[model samples]
Target: MATSSGAPAARTFFGHPWGLATLFFTEMWERFSFYGLRAILVLFLIAPPADSGLGMAEGTAKALLGVYMAMVYFVALPGGWIADRVLGARRAVLAGGVVIMLGHLSMAIPGGAGFVYLGLLLIIVGTGLLKPNISTMVGKLYQGQPDARRDSAFSIFYMGINIGSLAPFVVGYLGEEINWHLGFGAAAVGMALGLVQYLLGARHLAGVGDRPGDPLTPAERGRVLRIAGTVAAVAAAVLLIFAALGRLTVDGVTVALTVLAIVVPAAYFAFMFRSPEVSAEERVRLRAYVWLFLAAALFWMIFDQAAGPLNIFAQRSVDLNVFGWQMPASWTQNINPILIICFAAVFAWLWVRLGDRVSTPQKFAFALVMCGLSFVVMSVASNAAAGGARVSLLWLIAVYLLQTLGELSLSPVGLSVTTRLAPRAYASQMMGVWFLATAAGDAVGGQVARLQEPWGDVRYFLLLGACTMAGGVVMFLFTRSLRRLMGEERRAVPSAV
Candidate 1:
């Protein structure tokens, strides 16, 4: 057991520190808001103006959603740095929660497209601040505990995320079935509840996240501020110039972000590999990680399409009839989280029981294959749709189930490997580098989904599925060498949800 501030360890929540409960619930609500809004974002965009939506084209809507998602992850790099060197995790989380609340509220107000854009900007900045820091604080709760305990705490915290992800069923139903603003308002309410609990449970976290991991001295702080200010000014000026030239369209912004999302990770890898700080052994591990990163990106590119094209598929092509009622299309988005909650424990146990029978690289290969199969399911469903028949909702549910399994295989393993292989001096930066993989996946996935309009559903799904399967095969062939690069010893598997 780990003690906080030199006091005896107290087991207040399920034999874990009380702070875990606070952070857990806070994160749950934050995720509830995030996923809730995401579940309905594209649907809201494509809905007719008569339905209180912006009446945007489906392609444009998907592109915008992609850009927003990419930015949310991309900003985490600076957000983590700010928490570690400036405001500390606690204050950063608080400030982030406030901004997130305002963002949701702004969206809840039925004004114009400007409100939507403003809300997204605030939520992106707020998520950048909160997402990485809250997880850091969870680790702090078990600071001096054994690795087992810390791993257990993380498992509990991950459940909070899955539980929160379920909120889209409720919030999404409201937004898609009733009114868009109302759903946004409900998300705002969820965050408000989180903030209230966070305040009430402040006592449990007395010694945690109170200060930065590495605070800056006065001179260093001044220099950083100056640099940040200069960069902001230059960025603002460039944006203004683009807007004045009538060139700052949504398509333009999406293209720019897509390029940035791809380029940043490549640049990070180049910098890390070339840096003298990385040992030869660490460099070998980094090489292995790069391969894993590419596989992870491919998996996410397919999996994350759930929120864009899949949502559209559910609404337009799938039969939504239940026993006696037609369900809302947003309800389809709930399948993945629901399945994750149901099967995560079973997968965790299977991994432990199987032990060295499955290596990390092997798991990545499995995930890629599973992801391709999931899309294959969708491809078949699209064939049915092409015949002018609305496929059973069960088809979509099957796709989600397969994709959820793929997610379980890859996501947790990737997190553990990144932590294990990261160079000590660049640990945080390495974590940011890992997130860049997701940024690339989302940006590219969105663009790929856009192809559906031109390529048609059958060809789009088949092409993506075939390409993904090929990638998996290539990864499988390379797994032996990658595992060698990871070193010969079988390491203990870290806990992942």
Candidate 2:
């Protein structure tokens, strides 16, 4: 292991730096805590009070979950700002770990809805602090490495993600089959274990994320704080006013957050473009990123539904009877993770072998195609289920399989490319920008998914499926321009049309 003096990490763990191993397990546990709770969250929400659940309405619960997921990622902009200007990425990650552990522990308590809401609030803030910064550190670890190697490294990193995602199976089992609080406790324990190991491994990450990349001057700090404080106060006042008027419903809050998810990013993009700090070359790349970001947002809108309407559908429509034994519906959540584990490495190797022969836009196009096809298949399944049939679990499995392939295509590549296109001044913040795509997708997707009630599942699935496929076609048309924009002054970018 390297020391805290910021020496270069020894190349280990299949030619990548030793820091990757430290970060890898840390992320593994984080994902365990995150996905484990998520797997059973909707189930717990819809579960009656008699069953020790919150008993929220299905539409409301799903909306809440979608909005919650979006907000968690949406707040990453500030999280990245905190890292860039105040805490430093390393300390931000540590602070985030502690906060997340506490959040899970809070949820573990058997008490009123306040505890649950408080826990979720903490988790959202904590994840904002951790997720983007940790990924930024991963990119930092590969400073001076080839783009292909970095891309492969991200895929390997994503493997850790999928490995952690496997927790849903165990956590869901405990929550659904036993006590929900106990399941929350298990997630807390997982985060605790991750934190302990992270502390021990800190030395390996010494040079990386050790201090703020762009520390604020004392004058700048004071000005920013004043603005931030004012904004927070006004936001809180509005929320209080809404509550007083009895307009503070879950649906209302969800809709509000969803609108922010759209507007905030638009405003942020304008800020970045005008910030004299962004070089003209960086501006060109950012323009290319706008296109990619839109594609990614669409991809996530479909992919994230795995735990929302999709999870609900699995419970209600899919056959759980196997060998005359019923499996927990949440187990269906594991299929994508399982597939990710099995194939992410294969795709990583394939990308490495191909190098920049294929452009990132082309990859995204393929991913959209896969996403669309998955939904198309899902439409068929939903139709059968609506016709009063407990369709075979294989139907759902196939959807996950297609989605897992699409995820490998877009998610890791998106991470790698965001780091590449980012201006030097906005390094960590750029990672936050990447997560905003997910926030936008989930926010819009949540509202779009609610249409299933009025339009029926078949129509809802087919509509999204067809639209996404059209997005893939449009993506292909822009690949040549995107590649040229990305390749300026670069040796080997993702390549051409």
Candidate 3:
């Protein structure tokens, strides 16, 4: 096992065994913690209050689901900032794991809206710190060979996500079937297990995520503290204002997220345009990245539905009848991870075989199409259920299988592309920006899902299908230009688009 030092050895995993294994489990547990909570979150929201759940109205629940999910992704911006400028990836992951443990533990508490929201806030912050930074550790694992084990590593890594996701759905079924708190408590336990493994494995992961700053100068230290304080204050003010204005309510959350969808990107753009640090080429790339953001957001609008609208679709419309038995609706959440574990290898092979023939922009175009097509499956299912009969559960499963394949092509690959194309200094922030794009997608999905209540399910699914398809079309139109904008820049550049 070749250990990671100041620079990684230009060697294969066969040449550096421990490095790969270390990255694998660290990422796995993180995903386990993350996806487990996601499995039952919406169901928890929509579960009847008498059942010891949130008992939110369906449409409102969908919106809040979107808001909460969006806010979760929104944290990546600051998480990336703290990692790059302060804590470094390793410490960030450690801190994030602790926070996640606390968050999950909080959820284990019974009763009260305040506790529930506080737990969620903590989880969001923890995920922000964990998600992007953990991936950074994997990158650090193989310093010189960016492409060597990249796809395989992500494939293995995302499998962890699926495993985590699947465990939760199973736990949710048992817990909700037995006791609600049981499921929440089970999720907390998963985080604890992950944290223990991480701590035990710390020595093997030496030198991976330390911050670049040696002893910080007084001015630099002061600047960082001030900026962090300001950002925190701004975040607090926004939350309070939303609370005061009723934006945190089920009715207001969707609107609040929509506003944030506009605000965060606009703010980032303003920063980009004003920053004297960026060169003309970097500015142009940022514009390209913006377009990429819009395109990817459309993709997520459809893809993220797996948790919110899609889960509901399964609950309300999909039949689980098999051998005279019925399955819980939340169980459908397991499909993506299952399929991801199965198909990740196949997609990785395809990407390897295709190599640079299909450009990143082109791959993104395909992702948008697949997302639209998944929605088309849901539309068909929705139509099938129009006569008040449940569509076959197979429909939901098939759609998720397809969506997972699409995600394999786009989501993880998109992260790789961002790290490759973005300037070095902004790598973490660019990753955050990528997540911000997803935040928009999630918010859009929520708003679009709300249309189901008024427009009917068929129209709702159809709308998502149409928008995603249009995004795919637009991406195709700009494929050449986007590739040009990405340039031939290496991943080591200091700032990202």
Question: Over the stretch 1-497, how does candidate 2's per-residue lDDT look in tens digits?
Answer: 67588886566856777788888888999999999988999888888999999988877887888888998899888998899889999999999999999999999998967898889989999998898789889989888879889867776787788889889777888898899999999999999998998898888885899999989999999999899999999999989998998879878888989999999888988999999999998998899998999999999998999898889888889999989988888889899888877886699789988887777898999999999989999899998887678999999989999998899899989987998899888875787888899999998888777787788889888999999999998988877888888874254554455
| lDDT over C-alpha atoms for residue 481 of model 3 | 80
lDDT of 1 by residue, 1-497 (tens): 66777886676877887989999999999999999999999999999999999999888899888878888888889889999999999999998898999999999999989999999999999999999999999988887779999989999999999999988778998898889999999999999999999988978996788999899999998999899899999889979998998879887788878988998899888998999999999999889889999999899889888889999999989989889888888888889999999989998998888776678888888888889988888989999898668999889989998898889999988888898889777987878888888889999888777798999888889889888888988988887788788883345354355
lDDT of each: 0.89, 0.88, 0.75
Off by over 4 Å in 2: 1-19, 139-156, 279-282, 353-357, 423-428, 481-497
Which pairs clash in model 1? none
On a 0 to 1 TM-score scale, where does candidate 1 land against the true structure?
A: 0.95
Top TM-score model: 1
TM-scores for candidates 1 onward, in order: 0.95, 0.89, 0.87
The per-prediction CA RMSD against the true structure, in angstroms, equals: 3.6, 4.0, 5.4
Q: Which ten residues in a row have the lowest lDDT in candidate 3?
A: 488-497
Residue-level lDDT for 257 in candidate 2:
90
Residue 45's lDDT in candidate 1: 91
